[model samples]
Target chain A: MPNSTDTPSNDTPSNDTGSFNPTARSRVKRLHERGKYDEASVFAILDAAFIAHIGYVIDGQPFVTPTAYWRQGQTLYWHGSAASRMLRFQEAGVPACVTVTHLDGLVMARSGFHHSINYRSVMAFGMAKLVADPQEEAAQLDLFVDRLYPGRRATLRPNEPQELKGTTVIAMEIEEASAKTRSGHPKDDEADYALDCWAGVIPIHQVVGRPIADPLLKAGVAFPKGLAGYRDGARFDELLTTNMV
Target chain B: MPNSTDTPSNDTPSNDTGSFNPTARSRVKRLHERGKYDEASVFAILDAAFIAHIGYVIDGQPFVTPTAYWRQGQTLYWHGSAASRMLRFQEAGVPACVTVTHLDGLVMARSGFHHSINYRSVMAFGMAKLVADPQEEAAQLDLFVDRLYPGRRATLRPNEPQELKGTTVIAMEIEEASAKTRSGHPKDDEADYALDCWAGVIPIHQVVGRPIADPLLKAGVAFPKGLAGYRDGARFDELLTTNMV
Candidate 1:
């Protein structure tokens, strides 16, 4: 029997309702077995990552920009300075592909050909539209804060009017998406199994270290409840999923 | 005086001669102060990361695929199955951009507008060419393994002829490249400093955990010396730089 912890929660029906129909553009070509199209798998990978690399084209030239991102349902949002070329181009409803990846481990095998890395990645394709309504933009900004650290919006200073004016938020209603994941131990050649090489996995983890307070922090201010649990050595995935409240 | 460890070794002249002249296509449009054009910065960012998001266009639609990559001087290399769409299009000498990013920390601020992530990223643009020479391709494959684990290629079973034939290696002689880096605490509005919110940085680190040996490993085998320092709690950046023998 497989361990429950080893099985990802992508099969829970509550979060697995809609399936993203992969188009020829969004399909995983190389490894068909690792492809996943379910909403649950896509959402889980998106929610787990705060940064995404967005790819777009301009006059036959392709550019990939790394930026902060947040997801709400099937819609994804990212913001930057109002003058950002990436945001401006994306706001015009251009073809875009946003990808998020998490590195899990290094799979060491007895043979060089079989070495691989365990990772989970999602590629979402959509046309991004500018969020024009001021109220909607403000609400999305709040949600961004809440997504990073839940309840953080209520404690922090609100965005000033000028701040909102200088920022551009673009939303992409995902039209097609797919996720590819690789996990577990290496599969070496049958004959190489008896070789004296050490074969195994070295798990990789993204962890949070001790928080450094700002030099100008108010003397009596205490660490907020939203950040208290984010202690040194805490796992990033655990902090992201468990602190959603 | 600043601590020596805090300064990245980007000023070493032996590796920092040429500057990548920015083409109209590769210029950083916003926040020009963070842009770097020198080879040292670009190579440092590329060497620190094993994975890269490669962007290319097929039929006017852009796609970003994440894959493992290694850098040799000004040339970048990534491999996949012979049938991979990304490698196929890239090998046709189309415009391609390979980007590598390292997320350093989360900047928490008194105002939502100032929240940002400290990161280092490099974007390299070029035309990718297929490595058709079997001997050159095989040598590059060995270099890839040695890049990850120093002296690791000699200890493993060599790549079989069939294995070499099944894989496709793509190389991009970087035409233009630039790096962007942001570090330190958040800079909030002047008046917001008096607010009671906790404002600071929570450093993020990618670390290696305990190694899990293969279930079918021979009983008397010992951990390789190259992997001994990669025990639990080892910092990934330090390991990457220090292990490059």
Candidate 2:
């Protein structure tokens, strides 16, 4: 087995006491060097991705559901039909773990055993409760739309009363959260570096294509200004970072 | 509340006895229509994505960890350091739920309530066990490299005995699996269609950029033929479909 010296120490200093406290549930046990327990790191990963896989238990069985999520400060918000089982269980104050991951690149090493993927991920644990107030729900809905595409909320039709009633919004104050990120090139074995093999990284990017107009759109309707620079081949990372609020 | 008629019946026929039997745990309860139990559908979603969020219950708390996964016939394979807590628990035959999701596009609806995402996902449930046999573990490792990049195993340096010993490979025979997919344009309310708003889709794709060669002493190395066609701006869906093994 390779000695501890072979492993990379990539840990950076924790910001301060103001950063998120590392609870037993939120702590990273494996490869502890990759863990970050700061609000900045956790929120950054959460804000960059719109979808998350929420894990919750019912009847002692674990279920993971992928849904759209948005973060405001330390609170994470998600919604679905009021009758959703996953939402109901979460709203009832059960423990929920929300995870978001972005695959940055494929790390191809000289040996199969050393191959890995570069990724950014966050795991947040908390008890979610229903946003029962209609006014608050409506505001959060607007925020969600605006977060996805800024200023489009003002142009779109407002949510009807019945529409809001049918939807169930849930909010979880991130009680404990941790972010893990891996970047850069593959760290192959020292001796393997001398072997004749192409060892490098293949960058994986999520791109947003051009907006395709609806066939039912009225005549002379132009694309909204909010989506101007988000053209057919815009880099997802650049768009997200530039639009980060 | 959406009545039975308001909800779209997207369910297709479940193949006969040969198809994967959906147990109570694997069934999609919220939107029953979107559930699919056929092997073709489940395998398609599993094969497309290289990463998965594995959910498991530890002391009644759910934890979801995102890791690289590969499927071979009925068995799913994933590896990590032998010291990984998640792998150790899974190797002991604990219940595990592996979920893979691909966000296809953002459904821009006329109203915020109707806004949804087009996605394809698969949730597979099984009991995992460690691959302890050295010979079998070596073969699975090779399969994983080839699965990610075709014919990559032939070009890479062989794994050393120590490397295999340091890694832990786990396999799970999928006992229950289900696939869920949502596609096409937004289904807005009839009255909202008349309103003046650009209602359509913003296609989101995960693309592969040009391979960055490692800055080492290896000069005059040509680009591998296997990775030649995977250009920076290639569409993700087209590439995934064309390269489906």
Candidate 3:
């Protein structure tokens, strides 16, 4: 494991520290100040996001790939094509920046200028290494599957040898990171409140619609209980985490 | 105005490109067979997203801010605090990368290794300039307002002088860009079709829910008729453009 060094003060003072918040590492940014940084605050934002924008450089060319990711302790795991340019360059040890963001709502404040979105985002910088251990890769894969749909790993058949050989998983430990967020109502000046402009948040959320069964789902193999989060009218992320996790 | 350099090619390649797709423009990457670049393809993805990740370097520290954006022709405009560090450093003529992405659905194939999400994303590299002209800035603000709530511009009070002073609108002309997308069912190997694993797309989408009016709205000043799209639960970006433009 690589050690993280905290920059005393840098160009972006917001992210000079490595940790977001310790006490509430999982939900730090979600429930804290927008721009403030602590160990717990940053880690929470990073763990909750389902997808990430992975940035890396190859042949002096930079590429950002959107991929599914899961965080375990301080390390992040992602899998992709064994031959992808992004995977190749990333495994070679070039520094990479991974970002994940969640949009909460649209804040339509009284002043058009003060309008902003309520969001939580995390940015992390580190070098990724290919997951070379067979046992660790299998366990990480289990966690990755459970993150998206809990309890499915034990229900599904085991991976075959050829299947395992074809996939490539990479791991990256968090080196430097920061979490930034904005939430709640519009903070307009008191004087501007009487300007007759609408000022409030247009709450935004992700809700899962009715789930459609597979066209070829085997008869009598009803939808499993753990997969109920995909049903219609479910509140996407919330249902997945609350009911499944 | 920056001059446009047009690249011409004869042999139409179905894939991304083969050294002929305007490689001189630094932002455009030539993935050769692995690339997918088309005008409508890129625009559709860009137009579908309301939030973009703006990445820029200040004093060697990189910062990525999530901001609301509007695209007019080849120009992308976003507004923020005039004194904000993001705006100040962005105006220093540093090269910036803006990325917009929409995750469509989850693709689960026969093999667990092939699981991926169908997504569309675009990344553009350009220099952002402050919208210094009063008339131009006003027009852009109006465009932004119109974007969020179509005819609301005519119904609501106009921007005050102090409000304008507090706001900073930045516009970036597209220099070079690339769009990539993945869609359809999982691409499982022919032999895996008989593996008894579920194989199909779990279609994901962004659907708008009921609109909640501000609690303090004047009794008579109800949601305007021009804002009908906001009620239909259309895709966020489509509703934004139709209502504003």
What clash pairs does model 1 have? none
What does candidate 2's lDDT look like per residue over A97-212, in tens digits?
99999888877777787677778899999988898888998899889888888888888777778778778899989999988877767776688878778877788888888887
Put down candidate 1 lDDT per residue, B140-223, tens digits, no spaces. Answer: 999999888888899987777878887899999999998887787777777988898999889999999998999999899987
Better of 2 and 3 by DockQ: 2
Backbone clashes per model, in order? 0, 1, 19
List the candidates' TM-scores in order: 0.94, 0.92, 0.80
Q: Write the per-residue lDDT of candidate 1 for residues A47-72, one digit (tens) a residue.
A: 88888999999998889999889988
How much does each candidate deviate at the interface, measured as C-alpha RMSD after superposition?
0.9, 1.4, 3.8
Give me the runs in candidate 2 sitting further than 4 Å from their true place: A1-17, B1-17, B236-245
Q: What TM-score quantifies how close candidate 1 is to the native fold? A: 0.94
Candidate 2's TM-score reads 0.92
Best by TM-score: 1
Each candidate's DockQ: 0.79, 0.70, 0.21
lDDT of each residue in B159-195, candidate 2, tens digit only: 7787787788999899999988777677777787788
Q: Give the CAPRI rating of model 2.
A: medium
For residues A1-245, write the lDDT of model 3, one tens digit per residue.
Answer: 00122112111344543544422222323223345456566666665567787766544344456678988878888986565556765666656678888786776656555566767778777678888887888788878877876776676667777666656789988776667666556666557666656655666665554544456544545555667667655555565346464
**Candidate 2 chain A TM-score vs. reference chain A:** 0.92
What TM value does the first chain of each candidate achieve?
0.92, 0.92, 0.81
Best-fitting candidate, measured by lDDT?
A: 1
